[model samples]
Target chain A: MASVLPRTVQGPPVPLRWPPEDNRIPREIFTDPDLFRWEMDAVFTGPVWVLVGHEAEIPQPGDYKTLSVGAVPVIVVRGADGQVRVLVNACAHRGARVVEGPRGNVLKGGFRCIYHMWTYAPDGSLLGVSLPDDFPVEFRKEDYGLPRARVALYKGLIFASFHEQTPPLEEYLAELTQGMDRVLGDGRLRYLGSIKVIFRTNWKLYVENIYDGYHVTALHTGFQVVRLRSHGGQRLVPNYERNGHLWGQSRSTRREELQPVLRDMSLFDVRTKPTTDHNMMVVFPSGVVTDYFDTIQLRYVLPLAVDQTLIEFTFFARADDPEDVVRHRVRQGPAVLGPAGAITLEDAAALERVQQSSVARGDNVILKGTPKRFPPYRHVDEAPIRHFYQAYRRLIGVPVEEGTP
Target chain B: MNNADDLSVREQAARELLARYVRVVDDPDRVEEWPDLFADQAEYRVVTRENLEAGLPISVVCDDTKDRIMDRVTVIREFWGAGGRLEDRHYNQVRPRHVVGPVWTEPQEDGTVRVVANFVVWGTPTTDPAPRLLALGEYRDVVEFTARGPRFRSKWVVLDTPVLQDVFVYPL
Candidate 1:
């Protein structure tokens, strides 16, 4: 018999009280500041792919959007050559931030650092610096260009990684691509807009909440009031033992069958897709892609601190959509999915309460559909959350027991 | 009454309508009174300054018609379990308070008056100790002197900051 090789990760010992049963997660991890900082290094900057933006967001050359990758602020800009580059927002000269607003086109003048007027091209190559003649003997503009992350595109979705050893985008996504394709269609999407909100909870709670299907009908009373239930579907964890990405697929009740709760029932209508089947997927660490009803949304989870997370809900429409269809999407997208949406504020309420009580010190147990400790759970199961933590444990240097998977 | 006094009276009514709006939304018990402040065919939308300036059509809340405006109350009171239903109490009970200042009323070429004011809202959760700043924005409102009273023709809440600190249960 051949022996399995043991993987090792290095970090400071977390104040975690993990139990023998893999389902019980200690509350300390949510509140520990040291662990949060360590995660920025071990999990984010470690070998992992983080979704930054979609190609439709910056379709034109010199168009750019700014966001943070883990703790590092980055600019996701489309170069004049039609390639997307995730450059660090800081200037090479004194490290002053280059980009100011949320998004804009730099085609006119490129990114200029206001501190000393050091400027760079759309592709992040240093174009000029003020008073460079009085510099050192080895002064080279090529060497002083803003640092950037390795970028990969799966369809139109853009993913960025700081680590050199991160796997290829296809291998990283695994079987989740099928679900993404089902939602993305031909990948020709039009960017409508985005609503950025701060959730008063850890980033893990926000991501895990998406994996937890058990709370849907319970916490969100709107779902219950509409009498909408999943017809038939299952929860899938691709590469469960390794990455533990969640693909929650389900076919929902038709709009005609739903109860008339709202005066405008258009919020529940699904006109774009052929069937009522929808996907809510978490791409490993912190990328949420879902096509709930006719609304297509992508959530970027940015951890601001141990207790706070910034979630930008970016909505989209198919490039070939008609005017009425676009209007329906605009009216329905934020009404149901955005921060203050009818069904969405309940999550913020629930998650904030959870973060409040995490200081009480105990294990938050997972009971719903944890009979055998693996994937292939029901559509209304919370068991896939365990796999999420398992991948998290591997990255954070916590050892899994022998034959755990 | 003199022409100057009549003009001042009309402005007072417009300002009073604005005052009544802040009073209704700030009280948790008076959420039902919110939609009534609008005209029969009014539009209400809450959009971030970034998206608004960029000409993005998406909004955090887009109640463009009277039916949708009335439905916002239904969503808060009945759907969200905020109507004192203990069995299905999912949403947190927060006391909303709004601060309005530097009001401006511009009479358009037509009879409608445009009211602009800088406002900030604070939410104090029933369970938590600290009060959270929900949103700070400028309200670009159009007030029509209807037969009933000065009702809002349209109210656009333009947020000063793009990042909302937390989800707001009531209208801002």
Candidate 2:
């Protein structure tokens, strides 16, 4: 069944270009079923380590949580010996999922299957089968243990990779590690829980939407009412890099700089004093960690298909924080990123609208952020997205073809 | 005021207070009335069933006093934060299951009347015309009757739903 690629076809023979330097992303990337399949193989199961969760999520031994790795469901558990393990949730025999709950502790021992009473150790080693006499000579319980996935941790953040060739998690994180470290800090963290929402648009749209700084002022004007009114309007100055990573800083005129427009400022006392260095970081494929004053937000994007994505928003605070401070941080943080969050709610609506609009348009969507006159700017521009497409082209092995509106 | 029946009446009043609290939240415009239903010293919390069962000290929403409740309402309505049109209705079926101590004539002076009830809040989103089920959760409240009427001294909302649909901004 895996070999059946949907709608696979060779485009009309055209001039072949190596590492094509086109800034525009083909619209098919969003809606093509075949491309989606290829992405699951090339990106998700490829050499990139995907952030599974934070260590704070399962702090105690025997504690476990279930999540998906691409299309595959995985269970992350902390054994009694104080080691974290990621195991494929599927049962070794009938392939049924072992744990269904989001999180819980396995009392007395390891996970036991309800179907046949197949018990496994907390670390995913096969413990004992219900019956031994019925098994064939070659049917060894040890060989039937739960399969484990490669797991790695940086600071307290946990990540997993299916491909053995993936670079070390630290090297893959690259420059993004600095920002992530700052967010985690030296303090221990507790699982503040998670909010999961499914968006109708393709997952990449969600990733790009968060990474693109150009849309904030116009798209999120309603929620930014206080920020704009206080700062006398702000613009995002984006800094893009080569490895499909981008960070942006929001610059706004201070109260003293624009005293005339800042009259009756007490009306918007809710606005925290503006900081010059409001940073937004995007780690390609998935994972976006943003730092606002007094609060930090982690948005993990899991793509289910070309048109479906599961977005989980998890909030964190210092483990030893005062009750009041933790509560304050949770409240303020959700105001920006949660389901009722100002920016995300609008983005959700926009994503739905874009999905509807794209159905009527042609096969290509132009990324205007990329210039056409000069060769697509290499370092400073939206070339990161272009670079991503270049990587996409290599993995999918798709020949570049041109089309007219 | 010194009659023996005053004790039963006060107990009934405590139950009535919780009922009124549910009604206020159901009424969209009257949601602002929640703060007044509590005493000057009140505690409110919104937490998940897991945390509550595990005896974990955490809540998605926690307010210490009427002032704090008022501040939350003010921020939700006027603050330049996240915004979406939502409709939440709380249905609390309060049953005067038991009375802890000897009923007292003056309800505020003696802490005898204790009322416990089970509640369910149905939250629906209005932004989308379809109006899907956004959240369903239970509420546990402890009420105390005062001379004026009944006031909620403490309320805890425990949600059974495992995955929170989105950020819970309004009281459930």
Top-TM-score structure, candidate number: 1
Each prediction's Cα RMSD? 3.9, 7.9
Candidate 2 colliding pairs: A342-B82
lDDT of 2 by residue, A94-140 (tens): 77888988788974767888878888888887788787786888987
C-alpha DockQ of every model: 0.70, 0.14
Q: For candidate 1, give the lDDT.
A: 0.88
Q: Each prediction's TM-score against the native? A: 0.96, 0.73
User: How is the predicted docking of candidate 1 categorized under the CAPRI scheme?
Assistant: medium
Q: Which ten residues in a row have the lowest lDDT in candidate 1 chain A?
A: A1-10
For model 2 chain B, where is the 10-residue window of minimal lDDT?
Answer: B89-98
lDDT by residue for model 1 (A228-299), tens: 899999999988878899999999999999988788889989999899998999998999999999999999
- Model 2 captures what fraction of native contacts? 0.13
